[model samples]
Target: MARQIFHRSTSTFPADKVYAVMVDPDQLQARLDELGGPGAALLVYAADDGGVRYRLRHGIDPSRLPPMLQNLAPTELRIERTEALRPVGPGRYAGTVGVEIVGTPASITGTLRLTDTAEGSEFVIDGTVTVKVPLIGGKMEGILVEHVQDLLASETAFTQEWLARTYT
Candidate 1:
């Protein structure tokens, strides 16, 4: 079974600009590569008038894990079957992401909402990870939640940098 997690962040860019960069295949791929590392690969599984489909794979560095659960770290955090579904909206949009971690039957699903604001955009990302492991699973969940938050913060920073460079 999969759990649901939700997260949200607001950006200093309009909805249109944010959406443009998000749905742009090239931009998405480039950003993923930059964030996920050299081993990361993104595939456009589908793209049409409706929406876009993407598959992403990346290697996770165990060294990145917090000291508490370092012993429980998997050889790598392989995220497979990751998909982003984008739905149209009025001055805002929503997306859902599905991810599977390697060596574990558990999977995670994330929900993201982006809204246009007067000065920028608001982004919300919620993620839930279900693991088969009993005791350690809960702790792992906490770690994952923390990791997701960190990733989002880093991504927001990257977006800011990208926008500054592109606009200026």
Candidate 2:
């Protein structure tokens, strides 16, 4: 079974500035260095008329995960997250993103939207964490939701700090 996760955050940076930070290679690499655990690196990046796409790789200790996840990835887990965002308007973009954990039955699929707001940019992520291992899939989903929620909170703080330093 798949469990749903919804996230929303407001960034003090304007839409264009926030979008630029999201697509900027250096910013993302730095972001991973700080948040993506040990040896996290940007694996891919691209830009086109439509928008931007990037992938990041990192190592996760399976022992730190929930019992079900640890069972699925007994050893260290390699995480690959890919995201693609395309411009929807002057200050809005819609995209699909996914996280792939090698050697595991769990993956997260979702949609992301970034829109301009009076104060700054509104970021929304609506998704589901799907675990294919029967009898424990729902449990895994619950754990994943908590993990993702924490990650998002950390990311928002990082973005705000980075934006202030780089843009302001």
Candidate 3:
């Protein structure tokens, strides 16, 4: 069975600018570095219409995870994440996003929406994490959900700071 994870984040930067940084190779790489910390590797990068498609490999140390997860997951987790949105109108993009875990039955797929707002912009992720493993898929999904949510929070902070410094 699969579990659903919904996330909402607000960015003070406009949608276009946020999208710009997202697709820029240098900026995106840097952000991945921050997300992946010392274990970040950029396997691939491809520019898309409103966003980009990229693959990142992260060496997640076992010590950083609980014993249960440590045993369930490998020492390294490589995720191929894709973000491609078509322009719906000014400052708005709608597209599908997906995350695939290498060598694992776990994967995430969902809708990614970016829209301009009075504050600046909003990002909404409605994703489902599926683990085909029997008897433990639900528990594993909880762990993955928390991990992904943390990643999103970290990226949001990074993007906000980057926008402030880069845009200024």
Candidate 4:
């Protein structure tokens, strides 16, 4: 059984501005590159479709990990997914996204809700991850949760910074 996890962060930007920045292909790509290096790719939203796809490939350096895990050589971890955006209320939208971690049989599916507030925007992400590997699946779930939390924090910070630089 897959257990669900939820995480959220709020930004101080109007919905239109945030939405525009998110949907801009060049801007999104540039932000991803700045944050994730050359392996970042962004697929822009089209024709008010409100769906965007992006992938980030990060180099894993086992040397950075504890000695117990040092045997694992450096590898590329690919995070790829597409998300559908739908309006839930005025200045608010909620949607689902699918995430595939490359080279792992585990996949995560989740929903994220964005709300435009007077100060900025608030984003809530919730999801369940399914691990296809046996025996280690439970352990992997804990690892995945930690990884997701770190990723979300980094991405949220990057987005906030990018918006400040681009729109302000």
lDDT of each: 0.69, 0.87, 0.79, 0.67
Query: Model 2 clash tally?
Result: 0
* Reference-based TM-score, model 2: 0.95
Which candidate order results from sorting by lDDT in descending order? 2, 3, 1, 4
Candidate 1 to truth, TM: 0.82
- Candidate 4 TM-score versus the reference: 0.78
User: Which candidate do you rate higher for TM-score, 1 or 4?
Assistant: 1
Among all candidates shown, the one with the greatest lDDT: 2
| Model 1 misplaced stretches (Cα beyond 4 Å) | 1-4, 66-74
- Which is the better candidate, 3 or 4, if ranked by lDDT? 3
In model 2, the worst 10-residue window by lDDT is 66-75
In model 1, what lDDT does residue 107 have? 74
lDDT tens readout by residue for model 1, 127-164:
77786677677767766767767776877777767666
Candidate 2 runs further than 4 Å off = none
Q: lDDT tens string, model 2, 64-167?
A: 88776687777788889999998898999899989987778889999999999999899999998998888878988898789889988987888888889997
The Cα error of candidate 3 at residue 1, in Å, is 1.7
Model 3, position 93: C-alpha lDDT score? 76
lDDT accuracy of residue 84 in candidate 3: 66
Judge candidate 1 at residue 73 and give its lDDT. Answer: 49
User: What are the models' TM-scores?
Assistant: 0.82, 0.95, 0.89, 0.78
Predictions: Cα RMSD each: 2.7, 1.2, 1.9, 3.2
Best-first order by TM-score: 2, 3, 1, 4
